[model samples]
Target: MTTTQTFGELDHPSRLLMGPGPINVHPRVLRAMSVQLLGQFDPEFTGYMNETMALYRQVFQTQNRWTFLIDGTSRAAIEAALVSVLAPGDDVVVVNAGRFGLLLSEIAQRCDAKVTTVEGEWGKVVDPQAVEDAVKRVRPRLVACVHGDTSTTMAQPIAAIGEICQRYDALLYVDATATIGGMSTPVDAWRADIVTGGLQKCLGGPSGSGPITISDRAAEHINGRKHVEAGIATAGSVAGNGRRIASNYFDLAMIMDYWSDKRLNHHTEAASMLYAARECARVVLEEGLQARFARHAQAGAAVVAGVEAMGLSVYGDKAHKMTNVTAVVIPPGVDGDRVRARMRTDFEIEIGTAFGPLAGKVWRIGAMGVNARKHAVLTTLAALEAVLRGEGYGFTAGAGVDAALGVFS
Candidate 1:
């Protein structure tokens, strides 16, 4: 005797997403996602798939032949990379600079790898020397770290760490999800064996697709553990000599064969997400990498300058901060959540809250993707100034906006 209520058409508020990620996507990417779906193996769709691989090669600054997309969030790529290459009992050294570093360690542990951690302060980059020391001690098979940990708004310098890994004969894996496209992640120069990113950050697209590049060394290790599924195997198929990778969906070796000329089927491809990822890379290259990096740098500087002018302190080592997100210390008497709520309800802007230790103590303001521009920076600072004033935090009127304008000027 109960009637089911019908919901109206789906709708959402138009927000100026200045948060850490999933920021305002580019119009081009949105349009790309609206295209009609195609069969995964359709010749034209496959051509687009090939193009995506080539496009992300330029985005990641690598010539690796194993560049492609993992059809999930950034963490999916991270898990795939770790599980494929790390057999049980393998050794991995993780540089723990912030929350994401802990994530790396946890994933490696789940892979049954013996993980050795080099812990660093939350708001500071892990010293390259410390990572090198760990590598020397553990003689690990792999060294993993996050390039930019938005949790603390710190960016680890991976070039020196990469050199250390190379000298010790360990593969380097970087979760560049927060830094790629917005900052320079030179895979070749850093000698990074594996790098993974998501479209939600500076790539100016939605989540659900992870872009990844793997060096031949890492690919060979994964191939050794490759096992084609029985459902799709032909007579010529043979399991590799090494242990089969632990996860069926995340096996990178099979994914490679799927992307290769073999056209093997794994999971059904995420067609719309593929469109979005491809367009995301296209938009990035169209803007040019260097210019995009400079834009993110300028936006971050503007936010820092604005907050300082408003008598707010920025968290973390300034020299090692990520160019995309700025962590601002919440004033002692102000309610941090109230401020975020007001920013959303009143001004229609969105900012982020910190994780773990920094939670409730800091606010993360992102200037990423299509929002990393002068207008967006100024608007956020101006709204933040109003909200803080309402919260009874003392600061000179217009100081924040004026300082941000100075950066743009």
Candidate 2:
């Protein structure tokens, strides 16, 4: 006779989660996820979604009336934003500084948008003046850039680029998934029309939830294609046939209507993930945006100081380094993966490996969100110093921690 094995939570495994995303979740978020489920259309749940939207608006620093979760990971949010805006043969210029920007251009191409690019080296940021000059030359329909490209630990300047797009009458879109919440992103001041981010990075939550905010200007352009159900779209609500929307799932026109007074159906919202995203935003506001930025700023500085004290050099322009993550050049003769593995198993600590050309050459270290604290920063430094020493690198013991402590002091 065949027997069934007992299934339980014990069967699960745990990870240190020191990579690019899905960092260690706050305990409060875990508890929130354990709460009982509610019907998607239930009044209380709908209220939760509204609350989530309001909280994200404050996080995004936007007064955009149409903000909501995209119900997937960060890439899903990217697709939704690009697909809805790009029709066949539309022109798009992606300022490619790293992997994410390339991915965006690829996705836009798949959506049939004619794509162009201004490429930059992997550990370097795109110059705003170059982007402005490109906008004058390309005259594309949309200009998309990544605020923080984790693959390179570089943060591209967006303010002037947005200004250039404004002059050219092209919409400005930013993928801030790796930088938002951990860094100060004044969405309104920057003139970003569509901003999309993930819950995993900087937000102190798991993946599977993406929150996006779209300005009324962007909504107006998207609303030109409002294609709701024929029977349901009433006389005053529905637009002409030319205004019918493109993708049904990512239709921001109808999405805004559903999320707002229209109160129409879309999809089953991810209730637990929404709660986690809401709480993450709450933590940022409660701490005050300035204070939150200072924490990440200090921790990132401390990490850099610590790494330098160990006789290592950090990549990229120091002025352009991201507030949350850093890229340190891996010294010759030391195995990057071995150092990372030891940091994980021996110390219960984690650090990231670099990608692209910098892969195997730079170590990506993060001081982000909930992990941006004196304890995590100093501990990671101490552990790394020890591991590098054990691997026969000539370095003084406690050098990393001492350097970091000097900064905190």
Candidate 3:
């Protein structure tokens, strides 16, 4: 006999998240998500979608008319950007520096790109000259890289790489998911042909919506894959140049029609997530992007200062460290997992663990979006100091919090 267990009411602990991503959402974004849903094609709902597109254009700092949201996480946007433009056998040079950079390579490969990689150490940014040299040698159709890879807490320098891609007549694609709202990424100014980000990081929202912007040059590449659905195809309509995009759901050409005045039906949009994305951008713009970035910078510096004061070394190349996340070397003779578990259970605070080569060697602490504040920084530092002491890792009592507070002062 089998027994079916009945579950109790759904509830979760209110932990303070100071991690690489999926941070606490802004209150306004939460409220926006709770609003009543409207039909996808309802005039009111479509108006909101259009407004969201405008809002994200400002967030991406691009004048590209193709700026809009994809109904999935940041990786979905990455795949859409790559698969939409990259035909089978097209050469793509990927800058591999960290986990997300590796992800760019993986997705390009799935899109059938002839993937050539320029590698760097996990905790360091790929040198622009290296990327330029690779692009020159491969003569790729696209150059893909990660702007800020959370796993290593490193932000790659994109301006020079973008210039090199331009010189090579290759489209430049950047996964800016971790850095967009927390740091400055001027897409057009950097000469990026495609830029993609998610709501779960510094945007202060959930992960469903991915905001992406495409320059006219990139749009032309993507539009070449456009295909009218057979059911909706018109007798007089013409097909695009390239082969049909592999994934119908991620096809940007169809998504463009859905967002454009044509109002062509694609998939039903995730309306609540759209609302959340819009509110996320609204709050960032309300606070002023520059001020918001400065806030994250201060918070990140405080975390670094606090860790150093506690006698811990910061990991990675300090010059290329991200403004939102800091990686601290795990003290020798300490169980990193044990310390992190204690911080969660005792203080209800969440930090992150490193990935790949840095795993078990560093702790990734984040200060981003709504958590990029003085209080969040001090609280995380205080909890970390207590946990380290309990774990028998020697550190000066009160030094972490004191040093963090000094940054605010």
The per-model lDDT (C-alpha) reads 0.93, 0.83, 0.90
What candidate 2 gets wrong by more than 4 Å, as runs, is 1-16, 230-246
List TM-score per model, in order. Answer: 0.97, 0.93, 0.97
TM value for model 1:
0.97
How well is each residue in 124-219 modelled by candidate 3, as lDDT tens digits? Answer: 888888888898899999999899999999999999998998899999999999999999989999999999999999999999889999999989
User: What's the lDDT for residue 365 in model 3?
Assistant: 96
lDDT score for residue 335 of model 3: 91
- Point out the worst 10-residue segment of candidate 3 by lDDT: 233-242
RMSD of 1: 1.9
What is the per-residue lDDT of model 2 for residues 1-409, given as tens digits with 9 covering 90 to 100? 9889877767534445555666788777777888788988788988988898898898899998778888789888888888878767778889898889989999988878888888988878888877877788878888999999998888888888878888899999999999888887888989989999998878888888888999888888777655564336645544543334457777666566667755777776788888888888887788888888888899889998999999999988888889788888989999999999999888877788876777799888888777888888887888888899999999888888999998888
Residue 2, candidate 3: Cα error in Å is 6.2
Candidate 3: stretches off by over 4 Å: 1-6, 229-242
Query: What is candidate 3's local distance difference test score?
Result: 0.90
Q: Is candidate 1 or candidate 2 better by TM-score?
A: 1
